[model samples]
Target: MENHEDVDIVIVGAGLAGLTTALALHRLGLRSLVLESSESLRTTGFALTIWTNAWRALDAVGIGDSLRLKSTQMKGFKIASPDTGLFTSEQALDKDGKFKGYESRCVRRKDLLEALVDELPPSTVRYSSKVANIEELDRFKLVHLADGSILKAKVLIGCDGVKSVVAKWLGLGAPVRVGRSAIRGLVEFPNGSGLDPMFHVNFGGGVRFGFVPVDEKSVYWFFTFTPSQVPSYEEDWKENPMKMKQFILSRINKMPQHAQDVVEKTSLSSISIAPLKFRLPWNILFGNIVKDNVTVAGDALHPMTPDIGQGGCSSLEDSVVLGRCLGEAFLNKSNEEDDEFERIKKGLEKYGKERRWRSFSLISVAYCVGFIQESKGILMTYFRKAWFSSYTPSAFLKMANYDCGNLVS
Candidate 1:
C-alpha cells in the first residue's frame, strides 16, 4: 500500500456535515481535507426549516449571513385537520414580538450546501474521491479511495450519510429502517397564489402533509406515513405521478380546498420517495467514535427524522464542536507532550462526550413528534389537534429555540 504523511484530519463525505466541519476547522486555524464521492453539486431537492439553534451553529462557523440571503424566515405555522377539512390552529413563531430574538428560517437544501462549499478553499475539498475503505494504521488512519490512492491522517471524521463506509469499516454496521416512508417534492406556484410564509401541517388518518414556502414564489412540500407492505421506490413511483397524486388526494380528499389544490398541482417528475428511518439510540453513542485516530460525525452518528428539522442542524453543531475541541487540543499539545496521537485521541473523546447526550435527546424528541403527527384513528386525531392547540406558540418557540451550546456542558 502506498503511504502518505499524516495530516491534521481527514473528512469523508462532502455533504452538509463534511463541509460544515471543514469550515469550522478553518475558523479554528486548522486545515483538513474533504473527500467527496460526487464530482459536482447540484441544486436539487426541497427547502429545509432551520430553527434558532441551527442558525446559532451556522453563525459559529461564520456562514450564517450568506445562508440567510438564500433563505426565507418563517413567521408562523398552522395545523389543519384532514378529516374535518378545517383549520385547527395557527401559531406565529414570532407572535410574542420575539421574532428578532428567536427566529427560524427555511432554505433550499442545495443552496445551503452550495454556500458551505463555497467557503472552503478550492484545494481543501477533493471531489470524485469516493472512499472505499478505512484502515487503522499503527500510528495514523488510512483512507482508501476508489481511484487506487490512499491518504493518511491523524484523525478520520466520517460525515457520510446513513450508510457510512467509515462506520461500517469500524464495525458500526448499517442503520436499521424505522418502518416509515416519506414522499417529498418541490412545487412551484404560479405568481400570486397568495401562499403565506408560514408552514402548513395537514393531518389525516395514518399520514401527515407539510408545506413551507421556499421563497415568495415557490413552495416545498412532503407527505409521510407508515410504509405499506408494498414499497414506494423513486423510480416506479415517478413513472406514475397521477397514481401517487390520487393516493394523496384520496387521503386528504375531505380536507380544505386549498390543501387539495396544492396536491393537484404537484407533478410526478418533481416528486421523490424515501423510506423514513431512525438509527437506534444506543448505536449512536456505541462503538469507538474515535478508534485508532478515526471518528465519525453527523448522520453517521445521530441520524433522525425531519420532524424537528434538526438533522442537518445537529450535524452542523457536531462539526463546529468537534473542530473547536480538536483545535484546542492541537494548540495545547506542548513540545514536551509531543504525542500528537494522544492529543488527537483526547480531542475525539471530548467531542463524543460533549455531543452524544444532546444529539440523542434531539433524536428522541423528534421521533416522538413524528409519531404523534403520523397517528391514525379518530380519537388520536382529536387528541393530537387538542394537544397542539393547548400549547401557546411561545411554548413551541421555546422548544424550537433550544440551543445545543447551552446543553453541551
Candidate 2:
C-alpha cells in the first residue's frame, strides 16, 4: 500500500461532470487528477442543449466565449402534437428581450470536451484508468484500478454517469428506469438544413421527436418512445446502429417531412441509444451522497429523465459549486494534515447540502414532465393536454434560469 500513488483530489469519469470539475478546480489555482475508463475522452453523446445556466458555468471556468463561437444561438422553441395537428411556439429571446441571460445552443459534445481539455494542465486526465474497487484508508481513499495499481486521494468526487461505482460505494440507491428509451443522431446537410434556428419538438402516438440545428451544416435530433411501441423491436437494435436508425425512422413516419429526413440522412456512426433512468428524488433527498470527503456529482447524484434537457447543464453547475466549496476549504486550511482532511470533509458536506434540494427539485420536475409527455392512457392524455395548455413559457424556462454561482466564491 505504501507503493501506491497519491494525489490531492481525484475525480472519476471524464465526462462533462468530471472535466468541468477538473477545470473548475484548475481555475481556482488547485490541481486535480481525473481518471477516465476510456482510452481517450468519452464524447459519445453527439451533442447537448446547453442552456443559459450552463453558459454561466462555462463562463466561470473561462471557456464560454470560445464554445459560443462553435454553435448557433437558439431563437426559441416550438411544440407540436402531430396526432392532433395542434402546434404552439414561444420566443426565448429578442434584441432587447426580458430573458437576457436565458439563451440556449446545441453544442457538439466533442467540442465541449476538447475546450475543457485545452484549458486543463497537461496530463491532468489519465486515460484508460478504470477503478476496480475502493477502500477506506483512514483519512484518505484508496482507489484500486483494473490494471492492478492503487491510487490514494484526500478528496474523491464521482462524476461517473447513472451507474456510478462511487455512488454505489456511497450506498446511494440505483437509478430507476422509466420504461422508455431515446435514440439520438447527428445529420449533416452540405446545402444547409434550411431549418429555423428554433428547436422543433413533436409528440404523439407514444413517440416523441425533436430536432435543432447545431450549425448551418449539421442538425442534432432525438427520438424517445416506449419500447413496446415497436411490434418487432429487438434487443439487437441496441447493438446494431443501422437497425436502430431504421427502427427510429419507422416510428416517426407521421412526423413533419423535415423531421423524417433528418433521421434518414443521419450516418450510422453518429447514432446512439439508451434507456432513460432516474434516481428517485426521495432517494437523493435522504441518500448518503456525501460520506466523509467522498461524494457524487452530475448524473451520479441526480440521474433524471431528459425531458427538461438539464442533464448536462446541472452537471456543469455541480462542478462550479463543488469547486468553490472545496477551494474555500483548501485555501483557508491549517498546516496540520488532519485539519486539512477535516476541512475537506466539511466542504463536501456543504456541497451535498447545497445540491440536495436543487437535485431533488430537478429530478422531480423532469420525471413529471417525461411522465406526462410519454403517458398514452386515455386519462393521462386528458391530463397531459390540460397541463400543456396552461404551461407558460416562463414556467418552462424557470429551471434553466437558475444560477449556480461562481467557482471563486
Candidate 3:
C-alpha cells in the first residue's frame, strides 16, 4: 500500500531553513511540501544566537517581531581567561558597523521553529515522512520515503542538516569533524538570573565556554573543547542528563562561579552534547551544492563550527535567498515541463552561485576563530592575549553584519 504524491516542490527536514523556505514561498503565492522524518517538530538544540543578519531574514519571512518580543537584545560582551588571569574590558556592540543598528538575541530554538511553523499553512508539513532514496527523472525527481510513500517533485530542497542524505545525493560529500565537542544547555532562574543582557565568555584549560541571557529568567550557555580521548560512556551521558552535567562541570571549573552556577541550575533534560563538524571551504567551492532542480540549504549546504554563532543565522539567510530565487522562477514560468526545468535549473544556479562564496567564507572564519581561541601554545597564547583581546570583538561583530535581501526583492 504505497501512497503517491506529485508536488511542485518538496523540502526535506522541517528545520529553521526548511520552514522559512516554505514560508517565503507561501508569501510569494507559491506552495511547497515540507517532509519531516520525525513524528513531530524537533527542537533539539536548546537555543541559538540570532544576529542582525538573521533578524533581517526573520523579518522578511514575517516572524521577526514575534521572536523579538520573546527574547532580549544583547548589548555587548566581555572576554576573560582563568588560566592566565587575562581579563579583557567589556566592549559595547557596534551599532553603526556594516549593518546599522546592531542587534542580537539568544532565541530558544523552539520559539524560532514555532514562529516559522505558525506562518505556514496547515498540512504544509508532513511529519513521520523520511526520505529514503531519490532518483532524478527527465522532468521531475522521485523521492522515496521509508513509509512506502513516493513523492514526485518538480523541485527538491534539502535542509536535512549535518548528516544530510540529500547533500550526499547532490555529491556534496560529508561534513568534516573538527576534533572538538560542544555541550549546550538552557537553564532558567524562576525568580531571575540577575544577569545583564550581554555575552560572557571564558577561554582556558583547552576549552572555550560562553553564556548569554536569553531573557531575564533564562540563560543559554555552551562549552566547547577538544576531546583527549573517547569517553566510554558517551552514549550513556547523552541519555542521562546528570552525567552530562557532571562531565561539563568537571571540565569548566575555571569558569566564573556564576557561569558554573548556571550549569548547576540547569535541569537534567535541558542539556545536550555533540561533536562539532564542518564542511571545508574548498569542498563547498568545488562541490555540487546545486544540481539541476535539486539543491540544499542550512547545515546541509554549509555545516560550520558554532564559533561564529552564524550556523542558524546563515541558515535563515539561505531560506530567504533560495525562496526569492525560486519564487522569481515560478512566477514567470510557462506551462511546460521543459521550460519549467530550465527555469528551476537557472534559479537554483543563481542560489548556488550566491551562497558558494558566502558559505566558504563563513566556514573558514568559524574554523579559524575556533582554532585561535581554543588552541593551546605559547604563540597562540600570545595571539589571544594581544591580538584577539583588541581585535576579536570587531572581527566577530563584522561577520553578523550581512544582509540577505528581502523576499519581495
Candidate 4:
C-alpha cells in the first residue's frame, strides 16, 4: 500500500472515456489522475469512425487537428444487398456539400489514443492501477486500488467500461444483452480490390456484414449475427482467434465472390468478438450517474451497439459536457455566494438530465437498426430495404449531426 494522493478528480480506467475526461479537465485548468489497469496503452485495433458530432467534440478539447493527421475522411455510407449486389440506399458524405460542417474520419484506435496521451503531462495517467473498490466518505471519495493503495478525491469519475466496478459500487450491474454477437477485424487487401472508400453494410438473411476503409491499403470489417446461444468466457475461448472468422465465413458463405474473397483472406488471429449489449437506464447519464460526489461516463454509463459507430463519439461527448458543467461549478464557486459542493452537485444533476434522453435514444435507435439488419423473415427484409431507400438523406445527416453541446444548455 502507498500513501494516498489527493486531487480534484480521480478517473478510473484509461480507455477512451477516461482519457477524454482527463483532457477535458486539463483544459478547464483542473488536474486529474487517471488510473489504468493495463500496464501500457492499447494497440492493434481496427479503425474508429468519428462522425461529425464527435469531430466537433474532439476539436473542443484541442486534439482534433492531431487526429486528422492519422485519419482517412469518409465520404458517406452505402447500404447494399448481398444477394443482388444492388445498392439499397446511398447517402452523400455531405448533404450541403460541406462535409456537413464536420467531416467524418476513420482513424486507427491506437493512433487516436496515442495522440491524446501525448497531449497530457507525465504522471497524469497511472498505469497498472486497477481499482478494486470505492468507499465514499462524507468529505471525500476513497478509491481502493487492487495493489492496496488508496486514493482520495473530491470527485470520482468512473470510465471503467461496461462491467464497471464503480458503477457496481453505486448499484449498477451488467447491461441487458441484445441477443447478438459482433465479430470484427482489421485486415489488408490486395491492390485493385474495387472496395470503395465509403463505409459499406451488406445485409443477408439473419446476418449483416460491413466494411469501412481504414486507409488506402487497409480496411476494417465486421459481422453481426443473431447468436443462438451465448458462450461463457473461458481460457480456451481466448486461444481461438479463428472462431470469429470461421463464424463469419460460415454464415456468409453464400454471398458474392468479392465478399467471400475478403472473408477468406481474414486471419483468425486478427478477429475479436464483442457481445452486443445495451442498458436502458444509461449509467453515466441516467440511473445513478452521480451518487454523492461520484459520477460515471462512456460505456461505464451507456454501452450501445456499434451499428452506428458512435460508441466512442458518445463517450467523447460525455467528457466535453461534463467538463463544461464542472467548469461552471468552479466559476460559480469563485463568486463565494454559493457552496462549491452544492454547485458541482447541481451541475452534474443538470448534465445527467440533459444527456440521458439523447444517449438512451441513440442506444435504442442503434438497437433497432441492428435488429432490422439481422431479421430472418422475407417480409422484414423487404420492409427494411424499402425504408432505407425511402429515408431522406437529410434525415440521416440530421441523426449524424446531433451535437452534445446543444443538449448541455
lDDT (0 to 1) per candidate: 0.75, 0.86, 0.87, 0.75
For model 3, state the Cα shift of residue 375 in Å: 0.5
> How far in Å is the alpha carbon of 132 misplaced in model 3?
1.1
What TM-score does model 4 achieve against the real structure? Answer: 0.89
Q: What's the distance in Å from true for residue 46, model 4?
A: 2.4
RMSD of 3: 2.4
Q: Write the per-residue lDDT of candidate 1 for residues 1-409, one digit (tens) a residue.
A: 6756566688988878899889988877789998888887645566677778788888887778988886677888777766576767777756556555777777888888888878888888888999887777778777888888888877788998888888777777577777778878777777744677787877556787878777776678888877672465445556766777777777777767777777778777777778877777776666566665677889887788877677877887888788887886677767555587777778888888888777777778778777777777778778776774334344446546755451122
- Superposed by TM-score, candidate 2 places the C-alpha of residue 342 at a distance from the truth, in angstroms, of 1.5
* Superposed Cα RMSD, model 1: 2.9
Model 2 ranges off by over 4 Å:
84-88, 95-98, 236-243, 334-338, 386-395
User: What does the lDDT read for residue 185 in candidate 4?
Assistant: 78
**Per-residue lDDT tens digits of candidate 2, residues 224-331?**
999887645656765555878877777777667777899899988888778899998899988999999899999999999888889999999999999999998899
Would you estimate the TM-scores of all the predictions?
A: 0.91, 0.94, 0.94, 0.89
Error of 3 at 184 (Å): 0.4
Off by over 4 Å in 3: 1-3, 84-87, 94-100, 229-243, 333-338
Worst 10 residues of 3 by lDDT: 80-89
Best by lDDT: 3
In model 2, how large is the Cα lDDT of residue 361?
92
Question: In model 1, which regions exceed 4 Å deviation?
Answer: 1-6, 97-100, 190-192, 229-238, 334-338, 388-399, 404-409
